[model samples]
Target: MSAIPVKSKIPADQQLKISPFKEVIKPTVPHKHANYYELILLEQGGGYHQIDDHQYDVSPPTAYFLKPGQTHCWNFSCIPIGFVILFREELLTRECLDIVYHLPTTISLSNSPSLFELAKQFCQDYRIPASQGVLNTYLQLILLKMNEEMATPAPGHQLFSPVYYQFKALVNEHFLKIKKIQVYAKMLHLPPAQLTSICKTASGKTPGMLLNERIVLEAKTLLSNTHLSIKEITDALDFSDASNFVKFFKLYTNLTPGQYRELAFSRQQ
Candidate 1:
């Protein structure tokens, strides 16, 4: 099979985004791509990259998993030869993406030699002719490696961390209706405060932050990918009105709905 062509529009059917960047591409400053999950396989050179608030040295064999809406930067590094795969959480079998979610999303390459080697091999395989039927083979191997890592026992307080992953999965499922933190608490059978504490322990973010991040990301996707107006986005996100939705978007992104649409559309042109 020929290498699948790079797509202009992100597809809902595909569970992954795979592509290579070459020839000294200078990407913009640190920013987040809302609503998609990213797995990057770095095959060359070094630079500083930030995942959320954590910055790390990027080098060969570095693999980073960035969750939806987390801020990141490639501008800190020069053109680093690599392949990036961005997929929606729903694309994978629950078991596959779930294993990835269990890992610290912002992992440093130095911490996991096994994962790093797998990422390197995946990159090399990705660059081979798409007909090699090798892409699926390597991708599966990487997912298997992730599952292996998740099953290992780690020291204190980490074993129970899976609860927060479950909480995130629940939020992804219910974010449209149950925006309130308390609703998630009730659904998960934990007190609201206790749920918040668990989220903080596992993801270094509060429950409310996690919920809002998903909503904001979804809002951005609707705005960019559809012809929806501000009112529609407001309704889709379950906000009271366009005004409230605008306020929420601004609060997190510093961009109102109109401004965000303008910027996102401008990029396409």
Candidate 2:
């Protein structure tokens, strides 16, 4: 099993990259970026996109968001015309992070010409080597526009809370080592039960469930994409031993780690 390639599409010296989308002439293998977020805006396209566990159709006037460490691949039946925007965490402000945390992985941009124009402008200005400040402003506006299109009500208008988003960010950063709900609650300065309630209300999942899901997703990615042995993966994931890792994985996926790897490889063939 060859390791799944980790790609860095953005140049080393740049914190952001904006370019027009070009048709993929060959099948894209599953790969991930260790840092940065990718926003793809398509004016028109065909086929489907695989992001982690979700597969979304290549609909015209659609946007796809890929976060750091998430595996993704594209299989386009026809040429795709759009722009791909890549930005590192340095480029995100608190407000922008709020918007990004809430944006769905896939967004329908139909009836949203402003977004397309903004993306086009972003691509063009990127070539001019626009000032970082100007580029940051454009990125913020694009995110704000997408948030508006989501039609999410104001903070008070909805049952949502920024704490939930904060919790999610924390989990994304620490899920590999911290698995306790109480620890997360302590970090958030909320009681364990209150944190559970907030998570359930906001996303229909308990904090523990979310943590487990993240662990499971990472395990699957490693199993499917890398040649690491079971014991190696267990150690990397901080499991006590290979047997315990297999048991935990089976509980969530109903398949042992090796079996899951075989299934994943079969699908590729």
Candidate 3:
């Protein structure tokens, strides 16, 4: 069975859902949210969080912000206590989205005891009167504080340019139809060499590699979440044929489509 993309399942009329990490089952199957962001306030846990292709060790007392459409899975060694706050894209203020929650980041919040308490209060206080507004306000506070925690630059390395953000935006939009770096470079109005330089400098990968990352992410989601056969997935993804799609998936993931699907599903069990 393929793991289909799960759109947020929180009941309608409510824009937020908060839960604790103990409630989260282990080895969360690889999946993506089609509509919302998952902000995990993991105060206690020991494991690895797989976001897209990057695996981050779960250092207790860390805050993880996952953007929409990104795939993730969890492998925690023990039951952890923390709140997982889910919010739709619209709930975030424009400034918050653009500034605070632009990318997936996990940083230790152990030093910010007050911040942790605030999150705890949010989870506990949501059942009280005006909970929605209260939660929204709490979310805003959490984002702002997390922004401060993330503000420190990594020593000796600079974050990528806003240009790379533009590139990724284009990639997210057209990864299905456009796979070539040249097309994306032209669209960005940079020469291929210039585009390559920027991409390599920013992410240590070529624009072409980033393009493939997006496609493969979607492919993995489909394989794990749906029952569609390889041929159907090929057609759904606009591939010329099943064989070509298998070849493409294998080149990046080192596993054939069938193998990947089985592996992801087995872990879900």
Candidate 4:
């Protein structure tokens, strides 16, 4: 398969950029962003946005989170007024950006006024002649504010310590290859029992539960967002075979992988 074309509107010489929504009267080409993250805060507009294979309506007081390598495109009746924050992983590590990374690609924010106000401040700071440190502080504050709102209990947020955060970071990298909690525990230099205890104590869930959830989540993401077949996604997710993967996925989701994908596409239609 051909690789998805990726691009960033950010200029060179800056690892982080804040872009104001200029009037976009034309349809955009489908593309992805390599090795970076994007947060788009929309204040007012009505249109459609395609992120990966999922189509989302573009409504005001909403936000979108695009992780590195997510294919997306947009069309609008008129340009939305808002700001888009783009930064590379080097600017914010996987562990540091846990809050942003876990958020869904599209969300109708509950608190848009405060977020828009912060965006305005960030825009002002970008143009002012100030110390880079001060400018970075503003950037961090904007993300922190977003994180605060995202921590609401509706989604059952976990307050991550260093160890748990590191564990999750490692899982994000190795879950496709290493599904066993014992292996992850060994990699973290902790016994399997100890890892389970840590996970249970911190999040009221076992290490296996966390690992399996991540695996299932990734499988669902691929199934919902790509045209890969069952055998293909099975191989991509490191399952033993398509049958094994089907049973495992059905065990958790109560739906066959094909059923899940069809339902997802049906919703899109």
Candidate 5:
């Protein structure tokens, strides 16, 4: 079995890109991106997009957000026409980062003509090769508008504080090796209890739960998309042994790694 492919569509020196979505003649294989965020707006299309474990239908005037390290693929029945915006996290401000982290993975822009117009301008500006400051301003406006257009508030949207987003970013960066809430709190220069309160207030989940969720997400991605054996995955994830990894996985998903992989493959077929 082959390893899952990691694709980088953007050039190395460039930190941001905007362009029209290219037509796909066939389904794309499962793949992940590294160290970038992608926003795909579809004005006209048919079929569905598979992002990690969820599959969302590609209705017209819809938007999909892809975060770094998340696996996704596209299956289009017809050509898709819209804009694709890719940018490194460094391009975003703290406020933009907060919005990006809280925005729903799938959004319906049917009622938001302004967003489509903004995307059109985004493409135009990219063609002009606008200054980085200009492009960054446009990206921030887009995120703010999307946040306003969400039909319903994302989970914990009201309670989200800067600390929460900071904690989330840290967890994403260190979850593979660090699992303790105390360590995360110390890194944040806060006490464990204070961090716990902030996380709970912001997301309605404990710090430990969030850490486990990130680990599980990575485990599922590897199990479903990569050819690594169970032992290999266990080691990659820093588990002490295969048996312990299996037990931990089963505790969260009720399915062992092998079983989850089989189910994921069967669905693709």
Candidate 6:
């Protein structure tokens, strides 16, 4: 049940997915893509949530900001109820988007109940069939409050800028098809060595390391959140085969995907 990440060929202003599903259907398995950002409100159920390398037990009043390329998934005792607002980068100018992006995408609303309440209210208001102007106003206010409350960005905040953003966007799109830094270098029209230099400067990691991080993040998300067979997850991720995915998982996590999933679920019990 992994939802493959889709690239937005369309512009952002016209691209938003808002819905309320109460059917208790399986949640989308953890996966990653670029181009879209999400504001999620979990008002029901409890589960293991993996966003990037960070995992937590998601409960009512929990809010998470999911940026493009971060993987996520859930494990629940019962079907969950939540509000998910998915929007894209180009929907707003970089100045405004930077405010929200600077907020750590993974956060616990329980730490700030009042702010959480305000977020819920904002979501309610945005859901109304209001004029574009009104909706944009509400969105800005919400982001402003979040920015005020969010902790200062880490020292490496520079990684969130244009070149780094472009690099990450590329990883989200091609991590499966291409595993080499040289491949990404070619796609970005830069020499492999130059790309390496840029990544090291921006993220304090080599291009290859970042690519592997993206792949491992996706692997963990799928293993913990979805019902997909190992073979399916492996194939979808463009592994040579399941064995390769398994080998890589073991190399990084020191556990098989099945073992990791079993332990993750068992912890919830």
For residues 168-250, could you state the per-residue lDDT of candidate 5 as single tens digits?
Answer: 88898889889889999999999999999998987799999999988888889888778899988998899999999999999
Candidate 3 per-residue lDDT, tens place, 151-264, comes to 562223245265776788788778878878889889998999998899898879988888888888878767776788898889777799998999999998899999998887
Candidate 3, residue 3: CA error in Å? 3.9
Model 6: residues with Cα > 4 Å off, grouped in runs? 1-13, 17-35, 42-55, 59-61, 69-83, 109-128, 153-160, 226-234, 241-246
Candidate 1: residue 78 lDDT (0-100): 60
Tens-digit lDDT string for candidate 6 (1-269)? 55445444225556555445343646555566456777776766676676755677766666678777676666666767666666766566555666764667655555555655555565676667667666666566656665655567333444555666688888977888888887788888989888888888877999888899889888776666567889988887888888888998899889999999898677546
User: How should the candidates be ordered by lDDT, best one leading?
Assistant: 5, 2, 3, 4, 6, 1
Which residue pairs does candidate 6 place in steric collision? none
Q: Give the per-residue lDDT of model 2 (tens digit) for 186-232.
A: 99999999999999998899999998988899899888767899988
User: Per-model C-alpha lDDT, please?
Assistant: 0.66, 0.84, 0.76, 0.74, 0.86, 0.69
lDDT of 3 at 239: 93
User: What range of 10 consecutive residues in model 5 has the weakest lDDT sum?
Assistant: 151-160
Residue pairs with clashing backbones, model 3: 2-223, 2-224, 2-225, 2-226, 3-224, 3-225, 3-226, 4-225
lDDT of 6 at 264: 67
* lDDT tens digits, residue span 1-269, model 1: 21111232246665555666453747544455655677776666566665543457766656678766455555535667756776665545444545666556543344456655555566566556454346655665666665454435223333456668778878876898987888888888999999988888777899999989888877776665457778777777788988888888999999888888887678545
TM-score of every model versus the real structure:
0.52, 0.79, 0.67, 0.72, 0.88, 0.72
Pick by TM-score: 1 or 4, better one: 4
Q: For model 5, what is the error of residue 80's alpha carbon versus the real structure, in angstroms, after optimal superposition?
A: 1.8
Evaluation by TM-score, superior candidate among 3 and 5: 5
Residue-level lDDT for 51 in candidate 4? 79
- List model 4 lDDT by residue over 141-193, tens digit each: 76666666664522334554446655776786688788788888888899888
Ten contiguous residues minimizing lDDT sum, candidate 2: 151-160
Clash totals, every prediction: 1, 0, 8, 0, 0, 0
